[model samples]
Target: MDNAGSNQDKGNGKYAGKFPKIAQQTRLLNILVIFAVIYTLYLAKSLLVPLFFSAFVALLLSPLVAFARKLFIPRTLSAGALIVLLVAPFTFLGIELAEPAERWMQSLPKIAAEISKEIEEISSNIDAYATPPAEPVEKERSFFSWFGDDEKSPELSPPQDNTNSVTDKIKQSGIDIGLTLFGNAPFLLAQVLACIVLIFFLLVFGPNLFNVFVRDFPIVTNKRRTLVLVDQIQRELSSYIVTISIINSCLGLATAGVFYYLGIDDALLWGALVALMNFVPYLGGVASCVVLLVVGLVQFGLTSSAFLPAGLFLVLNIIESQLITPAVLGRSMQLNPLIIIIWIAITGWLWGVVGVLLAVPILMCFKIILENLGVFDHWIRLLESK
Candidate 1:
């Protein structure tokens, strides 16, 4: 009877020790699940990106929807208004871009000719400045010899340059670009579908989606706190998108005006490019300036005045960036510029243009959520505590 009692006590002790081990295993399993989920997302990124875009747009439209609802507008009408307001402008821009882009494409051959001419001029200028290596003059004093020239009937010395010719370089560049654009079409189609679907769902059920998240988390028992966090996330996302669009639009209009003032034929095209680039933060400004410079160089000859259009673009950007944008987004996008640039580049790599544009809103949403969480809240402090 004593030995049996001892065995029973030992069994109870062993069972108690197993709980911590079981808990550890469970924790490991959870971590693995998280990693697998992330991997799965990466693999399905094609499907995810467009849906993500729609989700963001839907969030962006929520405040407008809410305001309309408050004004006694029906939900369907409000949704339609938001969709039209959002989608119509893009469609119009697409149409507008088509003509300019086509013209630009048509102008490529002329541009190529101009480039070649400029290159030849540059080579001539360089040669003019350089002392030519003196070739030994073979004095051939035949009756048919040049009146004062000692130049031999130059047997075409086997073509002096083995380096890729300029034409080859141009053709290679075009082919490489064509191949890349071709490769991405499938992903692009997926993204478009995802955005439309996500946006539709968001407009129809954005409110319910938030509620479901709050109410249905398996272990996150704090429903109200989660709801508040989710609400803040939506607000921040919407604020970013709306603010970015308005600022970019204003910048675009101003840029177009500057180009018009400069007598550029495609002012609207340049402006649209500037506006689109502005969505990309730091990198966009430099890229727009470079493109404008090239356009200037192409439209005008390589004379002293060839850079004026580019200069105009620079001036406009300086005014818009240093004066206007700062005042508008000063308090809002207080995230670190360097970090934002990095995130944009990474997302842009994974998902391309839309990803780059969406990076800011996504970051804002993340910062908002992290602010509400416990340890991850430091990102908020570092990003937004300004």
Candidate 2:
């Protein structure tokens, strides 16, 4: 009986030792899977970007599509109509703004010269009061003097004038860009058409697909939970996107008004630019500010009022971010600023501008799923603003 007991104890100890090894292997497998997924996303971005864009747009327009259905409109017709209505204003705006954008492009050489001049003037003004550091005197018997002093010092070449070279390069770049864009126009247009078609089909058939998916779940509770999770995600995300769109539109209008009052000729363009960039949160605002500062410097020189445009924009942005957005989004949807920045950085690195725009929405979806699953409470806390 004692030998049997010892044998049993030995078996338990052997299994216990293997258990930790097995668990470690599982962890390593999970880590490898995560890395593989990230690599796949990076590699397949060209394909995935359009798909993601279609999905998000479909999600956004889902409510409008539902409304049109209630009016007895065919899903196909309604989807097409909604897409046109959505795209028409932007198409018009782009047509109107093209001339201004071209004008800016044409004036780049002048802008560059003026900016350089301003920088030089500032440096000269600072140099007037600033003491220059004294040059260090070389020792007569320095180490390695024997090796170097025998060799004639190579003659230093005079700096060549690069101004014309820079201008030429810029013109060449513009021409090359124009050529490339013209050449790729068909491909780009096809991609755009494909994405629209995808969105339309998704709108028309998404419900059926989702219902099928939910119905296929093995357990009743899983089916119910899946339905609830999807519904909440769609509802909340749609509402959030719609609200943000309205707010951004109003902010753009307000910015245009302010710029017009400040005597900017292209107030509408600047406003439109701001509104578009505002989609990316913290990084977007900073970029807008930098662009505004450069615009101010170019238009108004280094005067005190030169700072007004950017400064005023900054104030408006602060009010929008700190007061208006918080009040609108509320605590429930609030996310940690750090997580947002990190996620944006990661996505931006992976997929450029489109990824940056999609990062927050994707993160919100992740949070929503976690909430529904009722697991990873610690992760929920980490992601939450509070």
Error of 2 at 118 (Å): 3.1
Instruction: State candidate 1's TM-score.
Output: 0.77
Tens digits of per-residue lDDT for model 1, 188-243: 66667667657866887878766777778677688887767767777766776777
Q: Candidate 2 local accuracy as lDDT?
A: 0.83
Cα error, residue 133 of model 1, in Å, equals 2.8
lDDT of 2 by residue, 179-203 (tens): 6656877977787888988998999
lDDT of 1 at 333: 64
Q: Could you give me the TM-score of model 2 versus the true structure? A: 0.83
Candidate 2 runs further than 4 Å off: 121-190, 216-221
Clashing pairs in 2: none
Model 1 residue 134 distance off true place after TM-score fit, in angstroms: 5.8
Those runs of model 1 whose alpha carbons end farther than 4 Å from true positions after fitting are: 1-42, 70-73, 124-131, 134-159, 162-167, 175-194, 374-377, 381-386
Give the per-residue Cα lDDT of candidate 2 at 58: 98
